[model samples]
Target: MADIGAAIATRMDVLPITRTHRRATVAVGLGLFFEFYEVFLAGVLSSVLVKEFALSKAALPPLLASTFVGMFLGALLLGRLADRFGRRGAFLLNLGFYSVFSLLGAFSPNAVMLLVTRFFAGLGLGAEPPLADTYLTDLLPARHRGRFIALAYTLAFCGVPVVGFLAKGITEGKILGIPGWRWMFVLGALGAVVVFALRRGLPESPRWLQAVGRTEEADRVVAAFEAEAGITEQKPAAAAPVNEPAVPPRALLRPPYRRRTGMMVVFHLLQTFGYYGFGTLVPLVLTAKGYPVSQSLLFTAVTYLGYPLGSALSLPVVERFERKFLVIGTGLAMAVFGIAFGYSGSMALVLVFGFLYTATSNVFSNAFHIYQAEIFPTSVRSTAASGTYSLSRLATAAMPFVLVPLLEGAGPNWLFVTVAAAMVVVAVDVAALGPRTTGRALEAVNTDGAPVTAPERAPRQ
Candidate 1:
């Protein structure tokens, strides 16, 4: 009887990736693609936009910084909104807001107007990434959650290469007698149509509904999932109870979560600084090395090819390693390879190092992406992840203007070294201060079971 009961419980918990879930994932993935496309396209299209508007380098920083400012406000404000409102509502609203604004941005008459539009568009885009992470994590079984997160990110990173190819083709080729840079925004507008279509079928997160005291809605959503997966209802298995209260943002700041939140903020901030510093500025670095625009783009494309591959390969290993150690080790590897790429004069060496850098970064990224979502309860998961991740974006926002200047003044080698050193600092802090989260249910990491305790800080090396 005990064995039979356990079997029934297992059946209830392990929902298959049904068609609805798959469709929802794809839709969310596409929405994320557009968001990243906006952030990344700026680098590739900067030269074209500048020429079209007769804008100088001095004008570009403020224009770019404007979007970051919007993103910062959006993530902090809208993240809380998501926690208060339903994830589905927040998702649809954000999608509509960004899509429409992005379309309008395509028609901007001058740099100033473009900046303002992009900034507002960025505000909408900011809400999707963390919300998507939380929603998807809640849908999957604990065993498969890491792989699902990696796969979602894999699909999302495809945007990097897609944006590059699109920028290259449209900027070089005229379509309907309109310049390619203009077509980029046109495509961005089309992304809204996709978002609308996808949202029609996507379900609200069941865990989220339960947290907000909408237990009936949560049960109905889970019922739909069960029916789709061809499973019959059974009592949920007895698991360790989580200690978190079913409140939204406030829960994140309470006892166990407060430590988790603080650690994540530090981890994400350092990682973002390194990730965007290289990602956004790779073309610039190549250009500085005397590579022509075409060659630099080609190199950037080649370098990014490793991102999805790394993420794909990480899916299996994600479950096997301690999340904290995996993140720390991968970060150290990213730093090592990043510095090597900066110092290498030979193109072959540069490409090799670049590939390794992207690969290691993605490994670290996929691990942390899964880690952050698992650390909080459903009530505050999105809020915590978004708030922490927004810090990274804010850090990333400063990279182009502040870090780029530092790179130019100190040279690329020094820039790489600085990033490497930052990663070491992050890795040690994480290793010493972070907790193991692998193979655990989301509830396990919260205060419900064992009161979450802060790990000791890494001793200064």
Candidate 2:
């Protein structure tokens, strides 16, 4: 049963990319789109937040940091729920969490209430992405895994400009007698609700079902996939070895996986100080450069053009490029452009460097998100990814506290220098420790150069 289960899982992967796959990808991607759209709202509503809440500079960073704290908790605590239960259920649970809280945030009477809602929203936000990637990775073939995941997130990146444009348009608004920023949250919440409804019908991952020893159900799901694609399953070879026990999460700290866990810990923690530190701080930096709020919103909108474009352009080569190299290369690109962005004296330079930074950073983002989920086995994929992913959430949770003070004392250039230095360390860590996963079989990638197989396991409670 384990041998046939592995073969069925692999067969689903190698099949032609189908409408079912695309539909699932779009459904999954839409969830992230709304997540990124709302997340980037921090940049979008920076001025509005300051004005509407009468928030002092000191009051704002804590508000900003609260979301990541919720995210940190969500990822660390809820990540394993996907592995223990099911990806579809876990996704719907968290997406509903972010959606409801985001709408609740819009109704907040003051900053503190808004902060509380944002923190709760962040919990769902943090839990969704890695699990979302894990879901997609489980469904995709090794050959097309990188491309589909990159393209899926390319859809998410499109939200950057959507929020930027929406923010610019609503900057001076009293829609329904409420302010523009509140309306912004309303819009994001609405988008998430729609995605959540659409996602209700998605099939659970066949691999996850197989991993849990539900061979009959796994075969049923894969049969539906084959019927959709009009293909037949080929004969599977002999069984391969897999650790049969449903090892505890602590097993990740044991020998073989411990190094991968350590690599991700280093990568995610430092990488956040660079990505979120600069991204969320961009609007503030522009304002400090003497641009009025309106112009800053305008320039920020333009800078976001790179987000979708870079992710889209990377799709063709996603499979061709080695993921670790892409991760290392793009991380370096982000550092270089981020440094240039800090030094820009004119709007033109800011736009140039900002655009470049967004593009490369997204390339890095897509590569790393996929890479993180790829390293772990099915039994703990979401748990491991979410666990390590919490590092970024925790780091970003503190980013505003650390970054704002630096920007005030050392100026933007020095702030960027600090960010670039962190990314440099990330690049080194990946180049030195990241695994090679390009075009390799999931079974091969899991065992790290050993034969891949589904191990027999007793039913998980």
Candidate 3:
């Protein structure tokens, strides 16, 4: 099994980018697209719902927090299925789970029902990203792993702007007498279905197969990739001795992993304040500043263009810089831009800083997502990543209850000041404790789930 696993890892690590790789990345990315669509939709859709549902200020927090709460449960519960079973099956199951409940949410008659459905939808949505991070890290070659992962998320983040613009238009009018916000739910459900179909052909992670002692399947899958890359004519290289023994999930709390796990937990806990904290509150902040709902949603749509654009911009630099430095630099940038955004009175300054703030967030986002998955071993990659990721969900889930009151009482500047402080904590946490993963193979990063000694650094551009 060790030999087989080593062989599988070697073949995958050395292969050039190929059509097979792109197909798999796209399949995973499409699911992420819809997951984020539903997640971000809450902010815009909830703003309209405050009026449409005749929601009391008291009811608003529960409605907004429902999705993240469900996600919290989903990541904690369902995320392990990928590591315990296989990545491909979990991929299909999660999307199907989210689509059904989200469709039901479109027809929800009252706040309670909508909240319930969104929670269930979130259960499925929560696991999608951690699963994506695990699967992409397992599948992509180390040579340009960060670049390809960014490409996957570049496609994924497009969902953010799509939801924003769709909300801009859809919230204004009815489609077939169904309220526009409800239509957003219907559209997310439908798009997820399409991605479900598109993902049916995605191959299981070969590394996972080898890890679970399914060596024959692992070989066949790697062989197919080798053929696709037109490298089958060459002799197989001697397998390196695999040190990646099956480490139990509990190992994350012991020794070398304890520090890594602690770093990620703090990072996830604080980072959301910078990312989703700002994202979810932007419309409300604009509204507080006296922009009407229409203008708020419009400005949100324009600023959100940064999500995909920032992800695209990261592709060139993601591979060039060390992941930890990228994460640290972007966190500081988000704090600066977020403060600028909060202080701006002019519409022009608001748009410019809002766009910059959002763009920097995505770069921050891309760097950390890639960083998280790479830090763990294959046996517990999904478990560890999802476990930490669940913390982010929990933070975002509680964000409305905490930040909403702050926004109301302290004003947008102080609201942003809170977010900036959190980002600073994230920068410090990652800088002090995060490991170097740039271009290193997983086995080298964490040997037998223990901390690895310094490995060769990725060559600089």
Question: Per-residue lDDT for 174-232 in model 2, tens only?
Answer: 78787777888888888888998988999999888888888789889887877777665
Best by lDDT: 3
List the candidate 2 regions with Cα displacement exceeding 4 Å.
Answer: 233-246, 451-461
**Could you tell me the TM-score of candidate 2?**
0.95
List, residue by residue over 155-213, the lDDT tens digit for candidate 1: 87778778777776668768888677777887887876687777867877777766666
Evaluate residue 12 in candidate 2 and report its C-alpha lDDT on the 0 to 100 scale.
Answer: 65
Please, what are the lDDT tens digits per residue for candidate 3 over residues 84-127? 99988888888999999999998999999999999999998888
Two-way lDDT contest, 1 vs 3, winner: 3
Q: Could you tell me every candidate's TM-score relative to the true structure?
A: 0.91, 0.95, 0.96
* Pairs of residues at least 3 apart in sequence or in different chains that clash in candidate 2: none
Q: Clash totals for all models, in order?
A: 4, 0, 0
Where model 1 places Cα greater than 4 Å from the true spot, the runs are 1-12, 235-244, 448-461
Task: Output the number of the TM-score-best candidate.
Answer: 3
Model 1 residue-pair collision total? 4
